[model samples]
Target chain A: MNELFQKVLAENSILLFCYLIGSITFILGLKMLSHPASARKGNLVAAAGMLIAILATIFLYRTENMSHLGNYAWIFGGLLVGGVIGTLAAKKVQMTAMPEMVSLFNGTGGACAMLISMVEFNKIMEHHPEEMHRGHLLIIVLGAVIGTVSFAGSMIAWGKLAGKIKDKTIPGAQIINFLLFAGIIGLSIALVAGFATTLPVFYAILTLAAIYGILFVMPIGGADMPVVISLLNSFTGVAAAFGGFLYDNPVMLTGGILVGSAGTILTILMCNAMNRSLKNVLLGSFGGAKPGAAGAAKEGGGTYKEISMNDTATLMAYASKVLIIPGYGLAVAQAQHTCHELEKVLEEKGVEVAYGIHPVAGRMPGHMNVLLAEADVLYEKLLEMEDANDQMSSTNVVLILGANDVVNPAAKDDPSSPIYGMPILEVEKAEHVIVNKRSMKPGYAGIENELFFRPKTSMLFGDAKKVLQELVTELKQM
Target chain B: MFQEFAAFFITNYRLITIVILSIFLGIEVISRVPSVLHTPLMSGANAIHGVVIIGAIIVMGSAEPNDFVALILGFLAVVLGTLNVVGGFVVTDRMLEMFGKKKPKK
Candidate 1:
């Protein structure tokens, strides 16, 4: 008995040591992520920490009174399959598809939390039917409900973002969604109240929760996808935290709490940037039909002045300072490299160049920054909206490349505009404004840009890449 | 019985305090990230939640062979937890790789 006790003590001490190292590295890794330069290393360090934690749990931490490790085959098989699929998917997914990928992965995490709780509850039902703790039951129910919702909701979000699923509201979607939510809460209460221990009732709660998840995301529009994704991401984290509570695992608990709070803060930041409240985003479902409706009214916009490539080149080359604003158009045209090339050539000609990035410039937050960074653009040259506006009046020329709504003066001047209260880059304040786009077509919000019609603004119409390449050639000739 | 309950409460109290503290710590750490790193930061956080695989492993290790439901759920949880961890970290590394100064040709 003393020998067995010694072995157990040794195993536990080693496990504890691993957990300590893992948790510390996780904290350090997150701290390092504050700066762009250290972010990659931070990720690797945290991954190492996870490796240690996983290994210790598998080999060192023994379950009480077990003769041998139970079912190593299942655990190793899962790790092998999941690792292969995840690595392949991560390697293959394009940066443009990142939002969907994040959503999909987050869904998997939620599914795991849900499954863990279900398994735990099943164990309790079989082995300890006569004894049930209210706290444990409550945590299990919370995990089940939240995890199911996040899983189903994230899948829907992924489908919608990938264009595999259309944004369609069922008749009376709001009412149905509310009813499903109520039913889930009611069922959860009943389960916690010890009404029954049968699997069917538990499964019923899961089904209702899953349906509620689908309903929760069904009405949200593409424009609000980032916020919805972030919100659901937080739900998964919170669900995982409940799992942590149930299992009494500190590392799991810490990880879940970190993700939950971070996702919540990000969601709030996204809402504030878009000038919408969280309630408005969840309940109003505001951006769904606006784009289509506004697209039909495109005929009423004033004609924008056009500019030749030669003129745009001449203006930019002669300018002392130029500011470039990029948006989804740049991403669509795959023009980031060409845009960077233009900046390089213009800089060689003694012109100062920089980029102005709007908070919601592209499909996702920080979309423009990533695209620009991929093209080897200097990080310091990427300015936030406020800072860009601060220097706009002094800028010799403003290049609006594939960007519209964020630079649209209507956001500030027209109170009737749908995006009136949203903050935008004040590109119209620059001395000479040049807008590059495929056509006079409005942006994703489907609203006309009054800045495009300003006397100081002239349009250089073409695909953003082609136009930028042409401008680069013209600048070279000069 | 009262002493046992008090001990349980004390243990839980420590955990609850830790949970609340970690929440604040999470927000504080992420708040320092610039908008430029938001995507990677978010993805990295997504990977951290994959830590729950430990819980899944524990459940599977403790479960009996006859506990089919528990076995299946535990297996599925392990797979999902692994996927989230691997995918999130790899994608984040790929993104962050894009940033920084380019190397000069030798």
Candidate 2:
């Protein structure tokens, strides 16, 4: 019986069957992930499929010599250590820190792809120097370059998001990036075509790719991070796909391709949400400089009005309908919970309160929704941009909470504005617009919001959390 | 170059077919997803690429006992890949947990 089991494990066909099953589960899991109802279970299903694939590979793999795989200790030990660290980090991370954490995790995946390419390349050089095929070599070089870039780029993005690294655009930065990219491609071709088959040349390609990755992300401003992260996510996927090509592994190919396409589609979706093309995002260092200085100076419509906290609380308390627009500032101030408290208080006063979520609000795609969800805001009450805009005119009070660019009328009225033509929440359509901000500073786009100067708008200046807390208290008294 | 690619494709037609089909399937499945689920779904897709851990294991298990470079790289690759898989899914699940049972008791 033991011999029969070993025989079954020795067959490559059974492993292929397992891989096919894993691939199918990944597709099904991703299919279920499109909706909120089954998203958690969908993640589990994909994870279970990954586990099956891992176990099957451990027991069933055999080489050309029909030698079964060895070194059980290293394999299981590595997995155990990684699994524990990953779980703890994921569990410990706060929702506000999620974007940075995701970048860190994605970077690790990129590193893994690069390392796998290196290991496989080393294997070829050591054991089968004469068996080099251009196709195989190309996969190796492509995987190494792309994986390294993804890893390095993600680390920079993670640093930027975590506030550890400031955006730096060196002089002639664009020229330097272009040349490095050219050099990487040139070196990659040399290695792939056997012009330089030495490991040193291969390593040079990776080094150049890594530098290119760092430079690629270094100049991008905060507003473009969602697009940058999404693009890197796709690069990592493509790198993993090359790994699958190297091994002829269906599960890897399917998962990699799925991620690749998903990331690509998402990158496009985010760019559309910002009313910018992918090319425009890459070339334009948006939110990096105060280019908005000119735009703001030109749009100096008038001085803005300020409302007292007591009056602000009374205004919302008396309003029949209130629409709250939350933004990246809200996330930075950790005011989602307090904002939700205000929402609930207003609701109890027989006032209608619903959140208007801009697709590109906060620091990431869907960032505002996640923060609100963490505060136990009902999903139904969170309206997308279009939905919120449709209801804007009927809204008695539009409360802009630590949000700016998404609500700026400049996006609609000023064609010369940097964010012009970008879809914004039509808070100006509401009967009254009350904005909660820390100060008169411009938003991430560095442009002064024209809405602030509108006659219907009143700025309530304070920290979002403190102000919301005070408003909640004031409402309770009424 | 064309001949090389032709030979490669002939040998890898099945895998190539799988790759092509999966790309379309991926785009189709999530084409209409609400923007609210973007972050979780992106993180979920990120975790799925951790399947490269299988390749890492293969390199580790198949290397000669004396090949320190291969073994070390493979070990690190496995560890990082595992982290991508485990952390990605776990974090994605946590995010989705909040989205569960939308009828908030509060």
The TM-score obtained by chain A of candidate 1 when compared with the true chain A: 0.91
Q: Give stretches of model 2 more than 4 Å off.
A: A1-11, A292-301, B1-5, B103-106
Query: Candidate 1 overall Cα lDDT vs. reference?
Result: 0.84
* Best candidate (score: TM-score): 2
Tens-digit per-residue lDDT, A8-102, candidate 2: 55577888888988988888888888877778889999999999999989998876667778988999999999999999999999998888888
After superposing candidate 1, which stretches have Cα over 4 Å from the reference?
A66-68, A288-300, A308-310, A348-350, A416-418, A439-441, A469-478, B1-11, B66-68, B102-106
DockQ per candidate: 0.56, 0.75
Residue range A318-366, candidate 1, lDDT tens digits: 9999999998889778899999999999999999999999988876788
lDDT of each: 0.84, 0.87
Q: After superposition, how far is residue A215 of candidate 2 from its true place, in Å?
A: 0.5
Using alpha carbons, what is the TM-score of model 2?
Answer: 0.95
